[model samples]
Target: MASPASQDIKSIGIWIRVSTEDQVRGESPEHHEQRARAYAELKGWHVAEVYRLDAVSGKSVMAHPIAKRMLTDIRTGAITGLVFSKLARLARNTKELLEFAEVFRACNADMISLAESIDTSTPAGRLFFTMIAAMAQWEREEIADRVKASIPIRAKLGKPIGGAAPYGYRWRDKKLEVDTEAAPVRVLAYELFAEHQRKKTVARILNERGYRTRNGASFSDGAVGRMIEDPTAKGLYRANYTTVGESGAGWQLKPEDEWIWTPVEPIVSEELWERCNGLLAARATGRRPAKKTSYLFAGFAVCECGAKMYVPARRGKYVCAACLNKIPVDDLETLYRSELADFLLSPEEMSAHHAAANEMLREKELLIDAAESELKKIVGSENELFDLYHAGALNKVDFGRRHKPLSERRAQIEDELPRLEAERDVLKIGMLSRDEVLEDAKDLSDKWPDLPWEHRRQIVETITDRIVIGKEGVEIILLQVPFGNDDELATKPLGPRFRGDERY
Candidate 1:
């Protein structure tokens, strides 16, 4: 039965995303498009657009250009609903599916999946959306965890987990073996360095003799040093020794206890390799001085004249070489601690935020419930109209007139429920996040002095954007907290400057 309420659904977009494998198996994009169009026709909706993600992987589609365009249309109300063959065809990643649902619901748009019989415009369909999305997410996480756990076991067994073979070696039949051409050059690098007692001399000798790296580039001094130091040449190959760091910190070496070493075919004797590396180690030690102790606010503190402040050896203060301005390191840390205490949100403020968020969510929930109840009433009334018509008490025209408005209202309510529920979900997330953020800030403030030097530096880098030392006093500018919008919250002076402070 075509409800008059479906007339409100003006335009719908057909999502035809078929992977290459699916297409090869006879599930063509045209086949999916035809099926989606039929569903739109059945709903009395016009197919105004077709979003085709042909031959695209469903593993992660959000970052795709076509996916971004489709999201823009949903937000702009260009299409009221999206029709697809199934949820898996829409997205394989669980998180992306939920994101799609939220976007559709928030826009008062519907998602129709023919294979799953899912229509988000209905109350039952809305509930199924949440449950199905959760199940999918759980399944994906389980698979990911299993894969992560197997990595260490594979490393211990000397199996290739999945990375390119190291230089001067190749994986043949899943076993590591020395490359015929590169192995000789690698061994020569160690021998030449030990003979000449100079890294650059070895590199120059290799290049002048027409020898090149694996990439066909002329050998460099640093390349020679690394090649001589690698233990793979001496038969013992190390695995699971390094990992990627946070925020582009680059690769970092793992602890020695976690490192796994497997004996491989040697290109050079262990004694020869160790002798070459010993020379390089001695050169490094003799040339470079010991590193100075790093202060907490080394990079963050800036002089009033816009120059970076530095701490000289045993000076215990940040000195600006340009304008000759200086501030004691201890005093600056005290001011930072005091300013951080003031930055924390009060208990009453947190309570007010939570109360407002909860109240708003409650209003949306009540609206969804009321609409669901009204939809039931509309269904009952339609059944009564059918009975009256069958009993010959009413003519066909009279029955149609009475049924049209009720059908329209029922359709409208079904559409309204999902939108209300989506908004409520968004509010709930924000409210919960604020509470956690405020709690973390409180913990950091109370335990400032107890934190380690490295931990304190990380905290300062995350929260404090910059610190300015002026002739008047020091000003600490902090980044915006989750509860507030202002990013540059400058504080008053905590104390006076140190003795013998020079002004510009």
Candidate 2:
């Protein structure tokens, strides 16, 4: 150098920051601050003050109040130099760091980072700052890339991410759960929409009832409409989409058919859910689009002559396409109900089979109870170990070695719990078979003739399957397990029976 730099030129201020409370408890920020003070003292510089910002992110300069004051001091000539632990500690955002560097230049002040050996007073130091800024930008981009790549992978696995949980859900243990508090609001919204079929009316009802969002804000019509359409109320998750444009961002609703169904506990019965969808569709299309005719049995109905029985008209008229043999729609309806009743219950040996199914369910309940008890024992052991470590009875190394295996066991138990619970739900559902099948059978009998041909086809498909029309007669297949396997219920047909070549 032409001359040695003046040792007592100006006062230097130390800038120290700890990003989180955990980091504050650790030796990081304090150690960096100590090293920075030592470095300043070794250079024979006067230390003006040390400004510490705790739990502040480096991404935004505006968030740190103490850092802002230090910038003011440097600009007013109260400090000629600012020292920090590293470039990242100074600022992680490139634009803000460069902007502050310009301000430092204007005040004739110096910037020093002890860890990075960066001194912005010299040309070489300024080049190093530029390189640091470029690296910070690269780091940020890499982080964003990782996040983008992980989103779809997590979503497909039924993991919750991105925005807040839908109206009826709460985020718990990194998953979405039914929020007891908000569930009633969701039910009310659906009920209102079902009754009025008007978004404005639903919003008015909610607001009048003092129903508000999580933050206590009053509901808008658009908000109420969204709540009605969200699949989470039916225990499914749907991804919403957005597009960037000149106006800013545009959002669009995805159709229900395109949504992903993540099987959680159903809050509404399938029948009720279907009814609501039918009502919504009716309102949307202005007129009821003739009901969907593709039943579970539509394609499966084959004549004895190896031809399909096609329902070609609006009445319950079905004919064998190949042989031209026809049967009244009411007759086919009766044959299907009779077949289902027979499949569900054999009147000859009812008590034996009913006892068997009940016994099977009781055994399943016992297995579920045993599994749950085992899970509790494993959880209890983990809690004890955690308490020991907290009370200083165990060291970190010992706690970690024991805790890792316990956590693995607990995870296995958690995985098995859902399957066990599902089995229990199914058994409970099976116990209510009589009322369900009889009610459905009676309802179909009453509505069959009155319903349009297309609606009749839909109802038949909803409950029955595999109708084979033959030279001998028509054969009907029930879709699910018949409700009365214990008795010969099929012999007593619920509706009108069909004979060969019968006409309505």
Off by over 4 Å in 1: 1-169, 176-344, 383-393, 443-504
N/CA/C clash count, model 1: 0
**What lDDT does candidate 1 reach at residue 260?**
57
TM-score of 1: 0.32
lDDT of 1 at 304: 87
Model 2 Cα lDDT, one tens digit per residue, 1-504? 011122223467888766886485653665566556655543334677788877878877644567766766654445667888677887888656765675565455678765454655433355555664566446545644655577689889996554687887887865568889888887887777767767788888888988888788988877876676565676545553433455765654344333333434446543344344544545654533122233324455667777656577574556676677666655665677555555444544244435654665566567768877987898789899989999999999999999898888878766655444443433343334333434454455445557675444434433343566655565564432334433211222222234554342
Candidate lDDT values, in order: 0.67, 0.59
Worst 10 residues of 1 by lDDT: 486-495
Lowest-lDDT window of 10 residues in candidate 2? 487-496
In lDDT terms, how accurate is model 2?
A: 0.59
* Candidate 1 global Cα RMSD: 20.0
Model 1 scores a C-alpha lDDT of 0.67
